[model samples]
Target: MAYTVGEMARRLGVPASTIRYYDKEGLLPFVGRSSGGIRVFTEKDFEWLRIIECLKKTGMSLKDIREYIELAMQGDETIARRLALFRKQRTVLETRMAELQQTMDTLDYKCWFYETAAAHGSTEGISDLPDEALPEALRPVRERLRAAAEAETEEV
Candidate 1:
């Protein structure tokens, strides 16, 4: 079913101005216009919008997104190019996820550290505690943090 730009924006959970901005940026080439020249979106357009949102989440620039859209408009010949783009994006996202996981691990270790210290009423000797004193899952994180601190100390 055809939907007006406002209807499409509401359904997509974006502002109407965002939909208009996407159209202005040439990202909504698949969108049609009504007899009165108002933007009209179809179900297929919703699918495209979802893809655009996915790419945006991957930190893709609007220029790259526009290129991807243009390549998509070129039909089966661009299939390989699209696959390469997605593969590259997947790798980038994987690296980001790994880094975020490491950060979360560090945060988890810190939470445990502070909670333990708070229970003891002092941070004294906490950092010097044996690895066996830490939760098994946090042992590696503690080691990593220690190694990082040692490296910084040596650098200074």
Candidate 2:
């Protein structure tokens, strides 16, 4: 069944203005108009919106997204291009995830370090604690952070 722009926005969990903006930006080329010029959406349109949302979440700019959508509208001949775009996006996400994981690991080590210091009532000897004294999971994180700090100091 068809849906009004408001209904589509509600179903997609976005504001109607966002849908209107997408249309205005040429991202919703497949959307139709009612007799009164109101935007009309269908189930197929939801699939397009979902793709747009996915790409947006992947840090795709509006211009890039519009290009992707245009390529998609061109059908089978653009399959290879689309696949390349997706693969590039996947690589970008993987790199970002790895960086975020490293950051999280560093934060975990900091939390443990501070907790240990608090327990001992001072940080005087915390830095000198042996790796064996750290939780097994955090030992590597601490080592990596220490190495990074040392590298920075050497660079200075």
Candidate 3:
């Protein structure tokens, strides 16, 4: 079934301008337009938008996404290239996920630190506390920070 741009955007939970920007950026080559110059969307277009959103949220740039879409439009013979692009993106995303996990771990430790300090009515001597009191998952973050501090002391 055909849909207008606004209807499609509302259904997809993105701003209409985002859809227009994708069209302008040539990332929506499969999207059609009406005789009156309005965007004409279909169920297929919705699927395309979802794929575009996935690539975008996973940190793929507009240029690379356009390249992937161009390859996709070239039919079945370009399957390998598309697969390679997705595989490369997957690796990049995995690295980013690892980094984000480390960040979350650090934040998790900070939250516990503040909570423990609040419970004690002061943050004093908390750093001298043992790792046995910490969540096991946070021990690595603690070790990493301690290593960094030692490295800095050595540099000085």
Clashes of each: 0, 0, 0
Which ten contiguous residues of candidate 2 have the minimum total lDDT?
55-64
lDDT of 2 by residue, 44-128 (tens): 9999998998888888779888988999999999999988888888888889889999999889888988999999999889989
Please list the residue runs of candidate 2 whose C-alpha ends up more than 4 Å from where it truly belongs after superposition: none
Top candidate on lDDT is 3
The TM-score values for the models, in the order shown, are 0.94, 0.90, 0.93
TM-score of decoy 1: 0.94
lDDT of 1: 0.92
lDDT of 3 by residue, 28-139 (tens): 9898888998889999999999999999999999999999999999999999999999999999999999999988988998899899999999999877789998889888
- Cα-based lDDT at residue 31, candidate 2: 92
Model 1 lDDT at residue 43: 95
Question: Model 2 compared with the native: what TM-score?
Answer: 0.90
Better of 2 and 3 by lDDT: 3
Pairs that collide, model 3: none
lDDT of each: 0.92, 0.91, 0.92
Candidate 1 — which pairs collide?
A: none
